[model samples]
Every structure is written in structure tokens, then in C-alpha cells.
Target: MSPDLWSFALAVYARPDVEAACLRLQSAGANVCLMLCGLWLEQRDATCDDRRVHQLRQITDPWDRDVVQPLRALRLQWKEAADTDPLLKGMREQIKGMELEAERALLSRLEGMAQGWARNSKESSDWLEALAGEAANLNRDALRVLRVAAAGA
Candidate 1:
């Protein structure tokens, strides 16, 4: 629970069904990094509140929209051509790595944001819903798997 967000994210993401669930949620427009940060907070028993949520969005929105998304878009755009071109495939792989690094950086920022928050004794918080926002309904099954896996984390 005390693990840094990156480590926590890696551990939880490696669990069975987690990657597929995360991909589904991502395809539905959920920020997988934010959701992972939410899971970290949940595991740490941090209280979920509107102000913190707002702050998180503030920190995430610009970085995600400006940085991460572009890399993702580029990687996706190259996917079809990369399959036929070895050079393009290698470059696309690099973009994929960059995208992952961008996410890791975002998670570090999120962990820093929660540094002063105190953990509570409650068994759970409403973070998954709060973080998922509108995308929650679009992928309940994915969220369920993610939630269960994170709870174990």
C-alpha cells in the first residue's frame, strides 16, 4: 500500500485480466494513469473528496492532453504501416516506450499531489467512480476487474 505509484501501478497492472481491463477502459476514454493513481490512493486508504479530485484533474488534464495523448496518437497512427515496415515498427516501438514513460511521469506527479493526505481506517473509498467519471458506465466490467485487482493490491 505504501509503494510508490509507479511500483503499485506495475504490480497491479501485471495481475491477470488487469491489462485487458485497463485497455478497455482506455479505449472508452478513461485516463489509465489517473485510474491507476486512484487505485493507489484507494489502497493507501486516502479519503476521496471533490477538492482532491479537482486538483488531480488539474494536474493530469494538461499533461495528458498535451503530451501523452499525442504520443499515443502517433503510435496508433503508425500501427498499420509499422506492421509492414521494419524501420517503422522500431520507431513505433520507441514511441510506445515514450508514451509509457510519460504515464510514469504523470503517476509520479499524482503521488506527489497526495503526499500530505492522511490515510483513514475505512475499508474502501469511492475513488474508482470518482476517477472514472463518465466512462464508468461505458465499461463497468473492466472497472469491476480493475477494482477487485486493486483492492488486493
Candidate 2:
């Protein structure tokens, strides 16, 4: 059976420098969910191209903007208070769990969208490039780190 998106995401994000790389990419206007999906597709040897990347953005942009980002923002907003208030700390943790669930749902949707895509023999590096194209500010060093980590995976 094919690996599920959540599990794949967990494994990839656990890799050395991957989380940092993803955060860097996210700060540069790239969607981390899309980046995770790109890595999953690469692991599956699926074709990665501009059209596919566009399709991924269309599938995820709304959810990210509507659900995930709000949860994240709220969690961050509560961080200061949560540090001092025990009750707020628990609430913040709950919000963090919800945010994670939202991301999982997004990954599942992405997996569904790419379900019928034909697999190819393209190198995983190509997939990173395709996803990176969406980020206007991802620097060369960051891209190199991401590519190396992804290629190693």
C-alpha cells in the first residue's frame, strides 16, 4: 500500500534540517503544506511541473488561509499568556493540536488531488525545484539545504 501523507510528512519533517528548511521556506511566502506534498510526490516518483504545482496551490491555498493560519496565529497570540497562565497553557496546547489536525487534513486533500497523477522517473530534486518556483524569496542557500535534505530522503 502507498504510504499515507501524514506519516510521510512526519518522517520527512523529522529529518535533520528539514523542519528548519521548511520554516525558512514558509517565511519566504511558500506554503509548507505544498512543500510537504511536493516531497511526498517526489518520494512516490510522481511528475512535478508548473501545472501540478498550480493544482496543489489551488487545492490548499484556501484551507491554509482560512483554517491553518488562523489557528497558528491564535496559538502564537496566546503564547505569552500561556507561559504564565496554566489554564491558557492547556488551551494553547489544544489549539496547537487543532492546528496540526488542520494540516493533516490539508495533506490528505493534497494526496487525493495527486492520486491519479502518473508516476515518472524524475529525480526528487526536480520536485523541490517545482515547489520552490512558487516562492519568490527562497534564497540559494536555503534551496540548497532543502534540496540536499530532500534528495537524501
Best by lDDT: 1
The lDDT, on a scale of 0 to 1, for candidate 1 is 0.89
Q: What alpha-carbon RMSD in Å does predicted model 1 have with respect to the real structure?
A: 1.7
Candidate 2, superposed: residue stretches over 4 Å from native:
121-125, 134-137, 151-153
Residue 24 error, candidate 2, Å = 0.7
Deviation in Å, model 2, residue 139 alpha carbon: 3.2
Q: Measured by TM-score, how close is model 1 to the native structure? A: 0.93
Clash tally, candidates in order: 0, 0
- Tens-digit lDDT track for model 1 on 31-123? 899889988887778989898989999999999999999999999999999999999999999999999999999999999999678787663
Against the true structure, whose TM-score is highest? Answer: 1
For each candidate, C-alpha RMSD in Å? 1.7, 2.5
